[model samples]
Target: MASTPRSVWHNPVHFLAFGLGSGAAPRAPGTFGTVAAVVIYLLLPVSNPLLYSAILLLSFAVGVWLCGKTARDIGVHDHGGIVWDEFVGYWLTMLMAPPGWFWIVVGFLLFRFFDIIKPWPIRWLDRHVHGGLGIMIDDVLAGLFALVCLQLLAAVI
Candidate 1:
């Protein structure tokens, strides 16, 4: 693993891309980042799908630039500590989710599972893609996978 420099905290781009320092955790930084996302999602008033989707899209756009800049500064591609992708991915997963802590918890678990497991095309993309898009794409796909599952579960229940 590449060591994140102190300078990372100083750079605004790096700081945000690193999930406001949650990504700096020595263990499971991605998971920590996702937890941070969950907290952020809970804090926001997202009763409207259009607003939520717009925010998600904007985050993703900014994330691509920020993640790319941070990875360049850290001299690594998709550094484990660069977890802006996870933040955006989790938010995307929660889109249109039914109202409840139970669903949120389920989304978190499912997103993490798919992200960590990287099934099929997810793994392929992670291996083949490069740069900021690479870092964000796999997680986006994982989020989509989790979203599908959550929607199915919601329907079943």
Candidate 2:
């Protein structure tokens, strides 16, 4: 495991890319980062889909750059400590979700499940892609997969 350096916390880009330091957790940093993302999503006033989408897009754009930069600096591709992708991906998963703690928890589980499993094209993308885009796209697809599952559950329930 690549440890996060103290210098990474001091760098603005590294700070954000690491999901506000949640990614620096000794164990399951990606999971911690996703939890942090959930907290941020709940705090924000995101009833408007357009606004929510805009924020997700902007975050993803910046995440690609910052995540890539941090990975390069650390000399690793998609290091476990670089989890801005988790933040944006979780936000995307909750994009059209119903407003409730229940849904939020469900979304979190689903996103984590898909992200960890990296089924099909998600795994393919993760292996074949490179750089910042590579780091962001897999999580984005995982979020989309979770979104679909969440939507299906919502309809059924």
Candidate 3:
């Protein structure tokens, strides 16, 4: 096992922001990444969908940089461990619906499912794109797909 680094993981907020080093999880880290996001989401004030969306958008916008740096620090390309992408992407997926517990749970699950499965364009983007933007775009597209499915389901019922 690698020795724990000093001054890193010592800061609670940074550690969590890094997804409890879920970014460091050896296998299927993005799934664990989404789980970490779900845990944090449960604690947030999400009574307003728009506000939640704004925050999510901001996270995606900023995620380009943070994910890049974290990947760099970890010496990887689109490393599964760094899940700020998953968090922001999942939040975006949930934004299309009215804020509620049921929808939130479903959104988290759906986003995780799609992200992990990487269907169609999501897979294409992941394979083709590179750099920080690439790190995030596929997940964003996956969230968009999940959002559309959700919106369509809402319309049908």
Candidate 4:
């Protein structure tokens, strides 16, 4: 069971932190949030790497605040329902990725893998860090790892 906060619907901050309500899912909220992120990524104009990078920068900054504030409000360090990190993580994985559904699916799978596995530094940060930045950093690193794998795969194929 997940803590689906009532504030998620009524509060904008909570809503965003909840990955626009996708994080409210009873199970695998992070996966659902990542799915929502794929939709959002498709809607954005990311053909330009610079623009995409800018979007990543801005979203990451705002996510730190949004996630931190929501955690404070909900009194949870990183609630299962708070999945803004997933949204940004998926976007980061897709940065500079070759444009195609195959690539998108690959990126999605890779991001999910790294996010779930949380190898080494990612796991360490998740355990040691606190608040919004803590919540966001692990996912960011996962995305970066996925990005590297995806890019390498793209190069090989």
In model 3, pairs of residues that clash are: 23-81
Top TM-score model: 4
lDDT of 1 by residue, 1-157 (tens): 6676686678888999999988998889999999999999997657999988999999999988888888887888999999899998999899999999999999999999999999999999999988888889999999999999999999999
TM-score, one value per model: 0.97, 0.97, 0.79, 0.98
Model 1, position 56: C-alpha lDDT score: 93
Q: Which residue segments of model 2 deviate by more than 4 Å?
A: none
Query: What C-alpha lDDT, on a 0 to 100 scale, does residue 33 get in candidate 3?
Result: 78
Which 10-residue span in candidate 4 carries the lowest summed lDDT?
A: 1-10
Candidate 2 minimal-lDDT segment of 10 residues: 1-10
Each model's C-alpha lDDT? 0.92, 0.93, 0.73, 0.95
Weakest ten-residue segment in model 1 by summed lDDT: 1-10
Best by lDDT: 4
What digit string (tens of lDDT, one per residue) describes model 2 on residues 1-157? 6888675679988888889999999999999999999999987657989988999999999999999998888788998988899998899999979989999999999999999999999999999999999999999999999999999999999
RMSD of each: 0.9, 0.8, 3.3, 0.8
- What does the lDDT read for residue 73 in candidate 3? 63
